[model samples]
Target: MARIRGYVEALIAELRALDDGDVWMLGGGRLQAAFLERGALDDIEIYVMPEIIGGGVPLFPATGLRLSPKLIETKALDKGCVYLRYNFS
Candidate 1:
């Protein structure tokens, strides 16, 4: 998983370079978990979509991960995409 570590390091470096008032929208739970397992993420969010996937690529792959999150905010969108924020505790 050297590639994953490189990505995590690069992302953390970019994060360290950001100002205090920047917002980064992170997607992919399993991908995020990879970074989180390396202690690279301090915050996370999951956007719930109204549309159901018939059968395609899975987002949250079946992984043995347990992440307890606190709902920080929820946004109701008119375009069938709802944004859900949570504190990755």
Candidate 2:
């Protein structure tokens, strides 16, 4: 497992070259939003924490950009955390 950090295009190219199973984006919601906005991601796995907080960062921060990801799978974890998997359509 190698971690590549550089230009987004470079990372996308490397990932495409690898063509291995699923590529996971650990965090950085801004970066994730950018990738999704640029059509560089195939699927997204979002972990929802059961809580209500004020003034938190938004997941999809791109202005005026909307994405409707198809539901692929969902897993309910302990402590009220739910994992939702969606594929870009």
Candidate 3:
């Protein structure tokens, strides 16, 4: 756990040092959870599809931490899909 945390910290530091406009974590709930746990995630974008498969990996896993990010934007896409954007408070 300590090693993982160290790696996460290093990764975030490197990302912050970059000149890129925005860093995106495409997928992986666990990975996202890691960043969230470390307070490294400034915002998050979630895309909701029309189909539901009943069971699948959660957008964020249970880490005993709760967050209510401010909803910045929402857009309805074609085929009943939706895009949600939120920023951490």
Candidate 4:
């Protein structure tokens, strides 16, 4: 987040030139929560892959933030991966 934080600061400057209708792509659910805590993000996407990760790095961590997700879409991607997008707002 250190490097990304620097870019986000840059974004704060360039955001003045935006049309207020642009969307920024971001990953990292936990970091998203941090941004939200700092009032940077309001909407989010939570994608659950079809295959289970066997004892690897986990996506969602215990951030002490709880939210109810509303299902927005589901998709079957390449390599037998199924994606589930939820509205975190």
Better of 2 and 3 by lDDT: 3
Candidate with the greatest lDDT versus the true structure: 3
List per-candidate RMSD values in Å.
3.0, 4.8, 1.8, 3.8
Clashing pairs in 1: none
RMSD of 1: 3.0
lDDT tens digits, residue span 5-89, model 4: 7776666557646888856767676566655555555456555455566666657666676667677888877877777766656
Model 1: number of backbone collisions:
0
lDDT (Cα atoms) of all candidates against the true structure = 0.71, 0.78, 0.88, 0.65
Question: Local error of candidate 1 at 78, Å?
Answer: 0.2
Best of the candidates, TM-score:
3
lDDT for model 1, please. 0.71
What is the Cα-based TM-score of model 2?
0.76
Off by over 4 Å in 1: 13-27
- Local accuracy of candidate 2 as per-residue lDDT tens digits, 1-89: 12333577687778879957777777677678767767988888889997787678777665687878899999999999999999996
> Poorest 10 consecutive residues of model 1 by lDDT?
21-30
**TM-scores of all candidate predictions against the true structure:** 0.63, 0.76, 0.83, 0.58
Model 3 ranges off by over 4 Å: none
Candidate 3 least-lDDT 10 residues: 50-59
Better of 2 and 4 by TM-score: 2
